[model samples]
Target chain A: MADALLETRALTAGYGEMQVLRDISLAVQPAEIVAIVGSNGAGKTTLLRAISRLIPCGGEVTFDGKSVSHATADEVFGSGLVQVPEGRQLFDRMSVEENLRMGAYRRGDRRAIDDDLDRMYTLFPRLSDRRRQLAGSMSGGEQQMCAMARALMARPRLMMVDEMSLGLAPVIVDQLLETMTAIRKEGVTVLLVEQDVHAALSVADRGYVMETGEIVREGSARELESDPEVQRAYLGEV
Target chain B: MELLAQVLVGGVLLGGLYALMALGLALVWGVLNIVNLSHGALIMLGAYATYYLFTGTGLDPFAALPITAIVLFVIGWLIQRGILNLVIRGPMFNTLLITFGIEVILTYLAQLLFSADFRAINPPYAGNNFRVLGITIPLMQVLAFAIAIGLTVAMWLFLLHTRVGRGIRAASQNLVAARLYGVNPRSIYALTFGIGSALAGVAGGLYGTVSQINPYIGGPLTAKSFAIAIIGGLENPLGVIVGGLVLGIVESLTALYAGSTYRDVASFGVLILVLILRPTGLLGRTT
Candidate 1:
């Protein structure tokens, strides 16, 4: 728990009078792929938003031993807690290369930024071929890849990806999961919020099952996969 | 035929200045989503600032542009950060009311301080004219046109090349996403309004050299700026040039053919036509 890169204590958040997240507590260790899987409107996105400080939340969010609950979104991002938001929110009018450059907006080291750019192209080869293309013009799979690459350019210590598999083909989702594993192998912690319970747990080291704004179950990926309640509610397997 | 050629040339020159006038309004409207009804007031302030610098300090009006731009930039930054940002998230109507209020306050302030006397910046070379291809061109108008075009192009490049410029564009498209990439929306919004006001300042300085300036000129100038911005489209910065040119030429042609009294009729008529035909402006792509 002390070594956890990201930990939330009784986090609660909502929009206006409508509360979405209720006392949700979760932790992600360094270099680990942790998934928070749930159905639609289960507060997975709101939890991610709360952690990233995009929305106001109660309780505490600690990142890398520092309390960041009240930190502004810019501070959270600058502290290397980055998020690849849902819906592949790419700057539609800007070119693919520009989007990646924006990801490195906070970095001052020019040489390192360029090196990271090259690394991103190598990681997502399709992006290299379409560097000049507008981000919005790309296919959904390609856009998602670009979004992931854009976040990586920031050289974050921990990256939170929300709904990465949304509106994508199954094969594309598998490829993305492989990319997430590879990203974790490079010593970056990942908090993946996904609706696909089976796919998320397969690659995640540990998983939490969220239902209706609260975490109902939490365990190792293998344990969650074997749990009959989780299978019955999410995996469609009884 | 010679008269028509002369009028067209004059219109083109006027169009260049018009482009510069609308550039600031377009930038602010496009990025900040604040239509900035006070934009012309800022322009009026710029013109008065230049007028005073020329008369009081003996500085050339052209040389006074940067100073005016900086002054207006500060004022704009303060206005946005101090007033507009508070109600920015409330409703679009609040911004409209606040900006309009600013415009009225500025107009009254100018009237009390500078008086309603019409002033012009007349350098010794003001009356100098050059003849080319059987058409006479006033040196001051040409210089204003050249500076206008230069500033407009520079603004376009700044938006394309600089980090802050990219931040403005990114913030305009999506504030939440831009914040995720380490952009502070409040500061960026303030900086963008400042830049837009600076452009307006430069345009106002150029306007002083070419025409007469008065405190009441702000309203008409703001209306003209809106016309140009709409004709050019809000999406592209360079669209202001085309929009400016269209309005200038239309006005000149109307003055020459339908008499000077119908100039507004022609310009606004074209605006109505553009609105009916292409709601996105000339360069804006249909969504």
Candidate 2:
């Protein structure tokens, strides 16, 4: 709690006249993989949106000890709190290389940016192979890789990824989760949202069960996985 | 046969400039999603700016293009920041109505300040012509065409290579993700509009050398520009060039064979045909 890099308290957010998040609160510490698992319409994406300031929210959001509650998405990102949004929102018209270049949009260190690009290419060989192709032309799995690599270009301190496994093959999802662990080991904190309870809990050091809009249960990964209620509700195990 | 070759040459020259004229509109619509009904008005203002520079400062219209473009860029930035930015996310209808109002106001102001009289930028080389392969090419038309193609290529390169250009493309694709990359949408939007207006200014400068311009030309010019942009699609700058050339050839051929009175009929007829046949333009991929 003392080393919390990103924290949200009493965060309430929604579209106009329709409140979706009610008194939600959570946090991610440095160099940790935290997952939020929930079902459809469970406000998982909305929480990420609120933290990134894509939508208006009422709460206290602090990143690295700065108030990010009212910050715009760019400002939030500037403060090292970034999100690889759901749906792999790559610039479809742009080439894969260009899309990756866009990830390092704010940084001015030319040599480092180039190095990061090389590093990303190494991490995702498929992307490197299809660097000249349009982002839209790639398959869904390739797009997700590009999206993650693009986010990594920002060198985010707190990276929040929404729906890591959505619409991806089980094998690709496993590969991506392994990469997430490696990313965490490299000192970047991660907050992930996913619908796959088993996969989400497997990689996460800490996990939260989100229902409707509020955090219903919060504990270590083991606690959430072993709980009868969580297993019945989310995990397929009877 | 000679006359037909000359007409075809003339159409090619005119079409190059026409593509330039529609490019700024395409950019604004493509990135900012603003229809920019006042695009032609901005072009008109640029022509007036070039005209004044030529008339008052004795500067050649072609040489004074950068000055006109820079001035229009500033004006465009202001318009986006102060006026259009307020209602940018409100509704497409709101932007359309606002730009339409701006068009009317700009036209009226031009009439008030510069008078309703038509003006042409007739410089030293204005009357010069050269014969290439038995076709007479007006010096001004050739210069305008060259500059138009050059600028279009330059714009394409800038968008493809520059950091700001990448940001604009990203923002257009996904505003939320663009923000995560540290792009301020408001400023980026303004920058896009500014670039669009600057292109319009350059186009206007070129247009003044080829034909006459007045305050009231904005409406028809805007309509023509929109038609070309639709035909070209906003996918690539060269596509616009193709669209402009196609429209230009059709108009010239129609004028020669169907009479000048049927020029609009031919141009708009192609517009209708493209709309019915391929709404995404010839080059634009279906999404």
Candidate 3:
């Protein structure tokens, strides 16, 4: 726990006067896939936003053993905590290759950056075919792949993916889940936030169940997947 | 027929300068989403900076352009970082009011410092004109046109190819996503505003070589720039050229046919027509 790659203590955030998250604490160890699953409006997205420093939050967020609670969003990202925000926010007018280049914006190693570009192309072969194509023109599934690939180009130590499976076909979601597992194997820790509890727990090493801005349960992925209450409420089983 | 051709030639040259004038405005509006009312004042400052450099040090007005641009860029950077960034995320009207206030303050400062007299950068060749194919062309207009086009192309290439340019583009499109790539919005916004101001300054310097400059010039010039940006649309980098040419030709034709006093009427009329017919601009995507 002391070596957790990302840790938040009593994290709370909200829009002006409308609190969305409350006293939520979580941790992701190095190279592990930690999933936070809940239904709609369970503050899953808010938690990710708070961790990324996109929105103001109360409580402590420590990444790589540094207190990033007061760090700006760019500073957080610069220190290798990156996020593929909800809704695949690709630069709509830029080419797919340009979008990938933006990922390594802070890096100055020209040759290494180029090598990473090639790796991204190989990782997401579909992106290679449409390198010159505008990012906004891609299908939802392809855009999702591009988003993940874009984040990977940053060479992040911790990648927080928000709603990766949102609005995608089941098969595409499965493919993306496999990609997340492959990413973890590359030694990058993941904090996956999802609304689809079943899909999230299937690939997570450990899981936390959120309900209305609070962690209702915490256990190993297998236990959460089989929890009677979790199954009845989230898995749509009796 | 000969007179008409002469007017067309003059219009084309004038249009090129107009394109450069609107380029800065378009960049700020398109990227920072700040419809900078102070743009013309920035342009006016550039003209004065060039004027001072010429009168004070005997530097050629054209040669003083880079100096003027740098001065304007720093002023712009400070203005954004020190003032505009605070209210940037607030209501659009707040920025509008603040920029308008800046324009007023700059105009009064220029008047107080430089006097209300009209100043012209009369380089030795200011009155030199040459006739080609029965069409007369001023030497200064040609030089201004060439420089304007060159800068416009340079800006387009910078936005398309450079790393900082890419950051500006990405930041403009999505601030949150840009942050994920280590883009600091506060600094990026200030940088963008600085670039926009520098372009405006360059355009002002060019304008001084070809015409008279006074403290009151900012208002009409800002209006013209708005017309050009709106007519051209903010979608493409080069669209300003088309918009400028349209306005220049329309103004030239109006001046010849309906007298010089009607030129403003003609330009604004075209602006209204463009707004009604195609609000996105000539090259703007319909979607």
Clashes of each: 0, 0, 0
Model 2 per-residue lDDT at B103: 96
What are the per-model DockQ values? 0.60, 0.67, 0.66
Worst 10 residues of 3 chain A by lDDT: A191-200
Q: After superposition, how far is residue B59 of candidate 1 from its true place, in Å?
A: 1.1
* Every model's TM-score: 0.98, 0.97, 0.98
The runs of at least 3 residues in candidate 2 whose Cα sits more than 4 Å from the true structure, single-residue gaps closed, are none
Model 1 lDDT per residue over A1-238, tens place: 8998999999999999999988988888999899999999999999988887889999988999999988999999999999999998998888898899889888888899889999999999999999999898999999999999999999999999999999999999999999999998899999999998889999999999999999999999999999999999999987
* Pairs of residues at least 3 apart in sequence or in different chains that clash in candidate 1: none
lDDT of 2 by residue, A1-238 (tens): 7568988899999999999999998888889899999998999999999989989999798889889887888988888887899998888988888888888898899899999989998888888899989999898999999999999998999889999798999999999999899898889899999998899999999999999999999999999999999999988778
Per-residue alpha-carbon lDDT of candidate 3 for residues A1-238, written as tens digits (9 for 90 to 100): 8998999999999999999999988888999999999899999998989988889999999999999999999999999999999999999989999999999999999999999999988888989999999999999999999999989999999999999999999999998899899999999888899988888899999999999999999999999999999999999998
Q: Which stretches of candidate 1 lie over 4 Å from their true place?
A: B285-287
Judging by DockQ against the true structure, name the best candidate.
Answer: 2
**Per-residue lDDT tens digits of candidate 2, residues B1-287?**
99999999888988999899899999899888999999999999999999999999999888899999999999999999999989988889999999999999999999999999989999987999988888888899999999998999898888878999889877877787788789999999999999999999989888888899999888877888888988988867677888899989999999999899999899899999999998999878422
> Across residues B165-283, which tens digit of lDDT does each residue of candidate 1 receive?
78888898778889999999999989989988998988999999999999999988898899999989877788999999999999999999999999998888988898899888888
RMSD of 1: 1.2
- DockQ rank order: 2, 3, 1
